[model samples]
Target: MGEYNMMITEFPPGYRFMPTDVELIEHYLTKKVHCQLPFSSLSPLFQHIDANEFYNISPDNLVKNMCVDGGEQYFFIHGDKYFGGERGKSRVVGNGIGYWRCLGEEISIYNSEGDVIGLRVNLKYFSESSSKNNWTMQKYRLTCEYDTSDTEIEEWILGRITKGKRNDYSNYF
Candidate 1:
């Protein structure tokens, strides 16, 4: 990876890497789902690997994406199913070490017309024991209103992952 990536680089390191609700919906997800931004442009911020592949990633590598929010950032390709018939995840994504646990309620991402663009899902990486906490991932996915197909869902994923020093649950609590 380059020294720094994305328009997000304009801000200083101490600045919060997290985006507000409006910024996520208006700037990132809308542009992403509506074809305003090219796939190449979005690729830098996210990687296509599944979360299970995450364990192979060195801790230092994951730590490199430090955000003011106190977490290192990461991105992974979210799949359609887990094991056999899970609703929105796969067992392999975090099979052994931990899992991407969804936090809070799913908020609707809407365009100016009030049409739902997608949903903002906040997930945390946790170890099997439940005592170990890893990272927090914020993902934006196109709503069924736009494309209900699994393939489309796979293609339109964009995630922001942060691994902070403290595993604070304030955002969810």
Candidate 2:
């Protein structure tokens, strides 16, 4: 891994591109779901990939793929049925190597008209062998308002993942 990070965009220096839950669902996901833009335009600026595959790679490679320097986290539009259902979406956070467990912090998303648009949930990645938690993820699912004849709403949810915090004690001065 390199000692520093670099972004491949022309957004000037030190321009952090951090997006919020509302911006994610409303601005990005909603547009992607409703607009049905051309294939060339369909790719999100944040890029979409399987979350499980994320941890398998090295940090520098992840940083290169992410192409952002605002934060250590990256976002994606993952389509896994296991992560959506009920008022709170169900999720499959594990692959053959490890898994991500939810911390149970589900928040309701509301628009300006006070309409419930979606739900936001948080999760932490746990290593089976080390038995340690070291990564974090936040998922947002749009309610079934945009369901199609052949597809369910759960198939188009968005997720954001980042390195997690360890409870290592550096406090107690």
Candidate 3:
């Protein structure tokens, strides 16, 4: 396996990582949200969702902002549906469960071959809700790029989860 770095640059303000897809899913599930990206990417996406914010916020709020104005390019994975706006529109991808919107400008990430290794999608959301009556349960899209031949993206996500666990552990001990 080739060693690769899975670093993300554009996101909300206070994201954190989880160790497993289950953990990542559980976190969003409890918030009444559904995540559609691969568990590997989801973990790190959450880790850095809000790395620049200073206030305590809910994951849902963070997710909401991802869909608001100018929040599209911040995602690592893109959704499939397109939300129309003055800048452009957003689209939802991933079996109609995820979304991706354009953030107005396209940024490129290159691979070892100097080929564009990563693609960006604006934020989008799903229509299904984890709860039957909760209208507040809205889904947010992600922006991500992956290499079918490499596992660096997954490992990078796992690293974020590990770091989060360590931080959580330190607080209790």
Best of the candidates, TM-score? 2
TM-scores, all candidates, are 0.54, 0.63, 0.24
> Per-model C-alpha lDDT, please?
0.54, 0.56, 0.31
Clashes of each: 7, 2, 29
Write candidate 2's Cα lDDT for 68-139 as tens digits.
332444445555444532333334433445555667766888887888787887776555556544556677
* Winner of 1 and 2 under lDDT: 2
Each prediction's RMSD to truth: 7.3, 8.9, 15.5
Quote the positional error of residue 133 for candidate 2 in Å. Answer: 3.3
Model 2: runs farther than 4 Å from truth? 1-9, 35-44, 50-75, 84-95, 129-132, 150-154, 165-173
lDDT of 3 by residue, 49-158 (tens): 32223013323444553433222212222222332322344444334443333345434434455654333222223344323211121123222444546533231111
Candidate 1 wrong stretches, greater than 4 Å: 1-18, 30-45, 48-95, 129-134, 144-154, 165-173
In candidate 2, which residue pairs clash?
83-90, 83-91
Error of 3 at 164 (Å): 21
Question: Which structure among the candidates has the greatest lDDT?
Answer: 2
Question: How would you order the candidates by lDDT, starting with the best?
Answer: 2, 1, 3
Measured by TM-score, how close is model 2 to the native structure?
A: 0.63
By TM-score: ranked, best first = 2, 1, 3
- Ranked by lDDT, the better of candidates 2 and 3 is 2
